[model samples]
Target: MPQIKSLDELRNLRQQVERDISTRRHTGTTIIVGMGTCGIAAGARDTMHAILEELRKREIDANVTTVGCIGMCAKEPLVDVEQAGQPRVTYGNVTPDMVPRMIEEHLVKGQVVEEWVVGRLQSS
Candidate 1:
């Protein structure tokens, strides 16, 4: 952890930790972005930024994480959305432009973006 030089910094760190814990506790929803070399080359960083921005703009709470290669080079910049009791859906060839609709439809409306989905895994 970084050194906390002031009380305000401590408070900010506490709030961030609390939010992380809360998000972890609510494992129902998670957004995973691929960050491997191929993914990064395909603009995963921008997609991730867009996802975060959209979530914040919509006041949505979700656990966003990153993963290494999943062996789908053709489908670089893959994004996965996992919700409680629902299949984990992976959207391939994701771009920053798609984040807003994906967030609105998947997170806010509780509907998957079927057309973008390339894979699905049931929770064990």
Candidate 2:
């Protein structure tokens, strides 16, 4: 870490921090679905479609992406939600039917559905 010498440096640091926060918070929500072989066998594609449909229906702007298995085979069909500055929440064994409420509660309302949360990645 670099030393802070003057108040101007401190102010500049604060501004940089604020810009980072705003960039993170305003970049929009991202939903990542695990699409590995196990996830596919467990119906992750349906879950992804359901999530996309819900977002379209609600007119919520978000990015829906896919990733390979995170080594949680038994917990196939895993879904990870990252809402701006919030921590990323991972849900296991997710079904298409659960997408709507996940969207409403987590993406739209900024509340994690604790019942379905299997893991949480804290923001740095």
- Using TM-score, give the best candidate's number: 1
How well does each candidate superpose onto the true structure, as a TM-score? 0.84, 0.78
List of clashing residue pairs for candidate 2: none
Per-residue lDDT over 1-124 for candidate 1, one digit per residue giving the tens place of the 0 to 100 score? 9775777777888887886685567565889999999999999999999999988888877879999999997998999998888889999999999999898899888888899999999987
User: What overall lDDT goes with each candidate model?
Assistant: 0.90, 0.90
lDDT of candidate 1 vs native?
A: 0.90
Off by over 4 Å in 2: 1-25
| Tens digits of lDDT, candidate 2, 22-106 | 5655778889999999999999999999999999999987889999989998998999998767899999999999999999998
Top-lDDT candidate index: 2
